[model samples]
Target: MSIFQIKQKTSGAVLWTGSAHDEKTALDAMAREAGYADYASLPDQIRAGGVQAAKLDLIS
Candidate 1:
């Protein structure tokens, strides 16, 4: 199922107020949304764990 989340932009730690099957999935969703469509290489982050806070909010 889908879920909602709030993540600290400097720590990569995520907080969710909805149901998810697991934490990895939750982090994945957060990174994808926060990173947006340019996240073409994002799912890769999940391969090693979620995105680092430094990688988020990039305007490029």
Candidate 2:
């Protein structure tokens, strides 16, 4: 597994950070738990500028 960091795209706020088999799975899981429709919708929401934050960093 690799550690990943998910942050607020605009503010750079650290949202979720953990280890996962892959980035997509991690994002999907986080989105789902946070009540999002799906992983793809996350970026759309983020682009709306505040609907939701979307930034991912691989931290090992």
Best by lDDT: 2
Screening candidate 1 with a backbone cut-off below 3 angstroms (N, C-alpha, C), the clashing residue pairs are none
The estimated TM-scores of all candidates read: 0.32, 0.57
Model 2 per-residue lDDT tens digits across residues 1-60 = 666666666787766776767777667666776788766766665635542323345455
lDDT per residue, candidate 1, 1-60, as tens digits? 544454544466663344445555555555565574433445554435534322223245
Instruction: Go through the candidates in order and give the clash count of each.
Output: 0, 0
Query: For residue 28, what is the lDDT in candidate 1?
Result: 53
Task: Compute the lDDT of residue 25 as modeled in candidate 2.
Answer: 66
Indicate the residue-level lDDT of 31 in model 2. Answer: 74
How close to the true structure is residue 50 of candidate 1, measured as C-alpha lDDT?
35
Which residue pairs show backbone clashes in model 2?
none
> How far out, in Å, is residue 51 in model 1?
9.3
